[model samples]
Target: MNTNFNKMMFFYTMMMGTLMSMSANNWLMIWIGMEISTTAIMPLIPNKNFLSSESTVKYFIIQSISSSMMMLGVLLLLINSKIEYQMILTSSMMMKMGVAPFHNWILEMTEGLELMTMFLILTFMKMAPLNMISYLTFKNNLFIILSLIMGSLFGLNQTSMRKMMCYSSIFNMGFIISSIQINSIWWTYLILYSMMLAMILYLMKKMKIYYINQMTLNENKMSLKMNIWLAMMAMGGMPPMIGFMLKLMVIQLMLINKEYLISTLMIMTSMLVMFYYLRMSFISIMFSSLMMKWSMWNTEKSSTWIIMFNLIAMPYIVMLKT
Candidate 1:
């Protein structure tokens, strides 16, 4: 096949693999899906034009370890199958989803990848399915509590924006994982998190900035754009924004479920994380500068508008619904 055609094939294979993984009902099928997804993503990682080659190698090493662990756990589960096979299967899934002891590598690796890769792993893949899988098993499980505690603890002091979001994603995953105890209303939290993450990505893309220091309007005093800074504030989960509203709803949900201690811990983590968020937001928004005005570059204005609308409007919509 032609090189260009091969690249397309690889991308196609990745999508197919992801679809297969999501739809698979059996362990073997899920494993195949995972293998296909992993293989397909390998070639896409190495780029000659950017530092992505180094990132790719790091990603490969970490992901491969996790994938192998997941596969081994699944195989072990299969071998140990009994009348309670479904319970065994869920235990295996928990390992794959990076809950508890199996999750340490995930936290470490997310800090190593670039923003795009981090988004793909932690926010998109890791948080999303783990939310659902958390529901399929017992909440008080050792793995569940471990994931929650470590996720929150690690997220407390991240300075890098991408890494901070990565940890925030993990922290939020803890809350969502804890929600599995509720038996219902868990989907609401998942959906809210998904939407919040998408909006954050959108604002980041629109601003064409990555590092948290770049958005710091205070230190840069003479160099920051108002609109861009406002967008970053929204990303930090400020009031009147969808991110904030989603977080508030999650807190309320946790309280209703009588998860007072976990809720308190989560709130504390959020507040601790909020310091960086506020620092970033203040530098980006409140300290706007003429010298810092960012050019739109090749970004589509319509796309930015849509994202902005969602970030600003979703909270109001949720408030009205409640």
Candidate 2:
């Protein structure tokens, strides 16, 4: 009962804070909302077992620093009488979103967060801009570009699937941020990306993948190697997948906006990132043999079937839309 109470309180605080951050008219109010959210959840992270507790500590410290830095940015921006309240709010949002050089705190914070927590944080962070961008007057295309470039290149050799996904998520965030410069379609793009991510992470968790490398180890009776490879390929935005369609659509959006140089850079970086995905796939699928111990792996048949349906349906749905 106590656990349930804590969970409910955490959920309520986060939900309220998210709504407040999105709807607040001023920076001070948003800051308060963020603080409420932060404090409410900090205990939840540390209360978990083993590494999760350690991760929770690290996450709290890093987020505290980031929050301070963001507040500093807001104060600095506010010193200018010519800047509007919305301008200050936008700058704060950018810093919080970790778009680039402004993103100094994001990677470390991400490193400390557990996979499920990170996914939720990413989803929440993405929502802030969707609600706030309309009021922002400042554009930071350079920051967005830096985030994309760094996130893609740095994510190349991540051994842990969670870390890999975290960096990849950053890259995806960069694409969405860049799209904001192009049009309001950015919100739709972000929404679709978040939806896909939520589904993918949930499915991955259901498969008991605590790390990407675990996919190579056949603790389960099933041929995880092939399934893991398929999952990675889907994430790589390979053709005949929903991720591919999202990438193709966004890149075309970039091209149409005449961001030729940035577009080219994105394409090249995407290819580089794809190489790692293929590498993981090759190692997992090609090198590993199937396991014969079927009884040990007690994965739910119904859930697996549902995940399979979604995975297959995504591509067909895209084809229909196209």
Candidate 3:
């Protein structure tokens, strides 16, 4: 009960911090909020392993460096507003978000985190920084290109599910950043991505799956296997899945803005991402172990509801598109 209370307090602190940052009227308030969120999340990162300890330390160090950079940018901007300072602030937020070139820390941290912690980092923790970025003016074309390239190429050789998802997060960050100018589209993409990621992570956690190969070990749970693979395909932005619609919205917006080059790059990298998602799905479906009992076939009600929502929601998205 005591431990649970402590965790709840930390979680509340983290949420308050993020809310403060998002609603702040000034740079200093934003910085304070970011610091609060960072400090609050530290205790929540450590779990039942040495890896979690290492991850907590690494997370602290990285967040500290980014926060310091943000402070410096804010001070300089107050002294004399310059585009360089603005760029510095933008870069710091990108670093905090684990955007590529500053992305290695996220991959390492994901390896050690519990599924819930990882989910928060990938989705909720990103909101404050993303909101701050939207208030800045920076040429994100280079960041977009680098994130897509690195996320696609690095993910291909990864067998760890967490690491692969980190790469996918990086790739999706490019689209998120691209859509930032259109607030509605940006929120839409973020919400869709969060839902898809949460579904995949929850399924993986329930099945005790840490790696791609582990997915094949669930011998008698075909329905569960199907759910995981379908979630992966959705995450990879396959057509008819809600993820594809989300990406298509971003791409359409980019084309309307005459960003043909970035749109083309996005499409190409998405295909590469789809390849790995398909590979994982194929492995899950084709390979099975003979070690589990037949009675393990029961699917959880929550998971079934999630899958049913995915199926039911896609048609509405299609209709909206038409």
Candidate 4:
């Protein structure tokens, strides 16, 4: 499945599709681009095992339905010349982005795929739909609130690392959408979230980790263990991290705009998410009491760069802000 040519083809084709969606001037081409990206990514979903194959099918069907809904919404707009159809279009794209309430497919799909592919799906595959979403008139505020609440509450008990991240993605999507109601903050949240997630993925890849149950924190060197912990903390949007700054900015925007109820809901739901992160961190520390060999941590040169980035990324961004 990792054939060089095939992988190259998938990468190129998906990029083409994403670029098409982003650059399209008209609605039709945008939808076409969306469909193309969807189709291109289907082959990339990794059908190497029975579970992966099932996940591929599930991914295909969910995407197809979401795309169809978007098309239907577009057609309604064309026929009726009504702003109401925009809601339909936006909701469909929200579903495509795995916003909560429509979030389970992404969780199931990520659970079934391998790590690199999961990273691709989580990051790259989301851009086109998100681009489309950003252009639509922003009236889906209720969906945004629901996505945050559901992502936080449901993620509380998740045992799998990937699933928790999926919920994290959903919760963050709410912030992304909320930022849409304001201006410019969405990009900040998205970039910081992606950066934090990239750090998590890098550590997991370096350690060949896919599950909480499979890997022990004590198995890695102390420094690397701390990186993973901090990465999780950052991803969970804890204080003194870049992710927290992103949330703080969003919250400030929300309060300034007098979205007091939304602000309160967000703050409360975020605590639920933070609780699970603490729970997971505690589990990792509790289970892995044995100290790993120090040599295991610095075995690769890449470790040096990731550690530097991990330690510096948030503080540097915070410094820039100041």
* Each candidate: RMSD: 5.4, 4.4, 2.8, 2.7
For each candidate in turn, the TM-score is 0.71, 0.78, 0.93, 0.89
| Tens-place lDDT digits, model 1, residues 1-322 | 1258776887688778767876788766766786786678667555443555665576566556656655665666667754444454455555545565556555555544444445555543443245336535444435545555665566556566666666566566666666565534455565655655665665566566566666643333322244444444554567766556656766777788787876777676666556666666666754445453354233455445644764667656576537
lDDT on C-alpha atoms for all candidate structures: 0.57, 0.64, 0.87, 0.77
**Span of ten consecutive residues with least summed lDDT in model 3:** 289-298
lDDT of 3 by residue, 218-292 (tens): 653667777887798899988778888888988988899999999999999999999999999888877874434
What's the lDDT of the predicted structure labeled candidate 3?
A: 0.87
Candidates sorted by TM-score, descending order?
3, 4, 2, 1
**What is the RMSD, in Å, between candidate 4 and the native fold over all Cα?**
2.7
Give the per-residue lDDT of model 4 (tens digit) for 190-238.
7667777887877777666776765554365555666676677777778
Q: After superposition, how far is residue 249 of candidate 3 from its true place, in Å?
A: 0.3
Clashing pairs in 4: none
Residue 23 CA displacement from its true place in model 1, Å? 1.9
Query: How far is 199's C-alpha from truth in model 3 (Å)?
Result: 0.7
How far out, in Å, is residue 322 in model 3?
A: 8.2
Find the 10 residues in a row with the least total lDDT in model 4.
Answer: 291-300
Per-residue error (Å), model 3, residue 73: 1.1
Model 2: pairs clashing at backbone N, Cα or C within 3 Å: 161-212
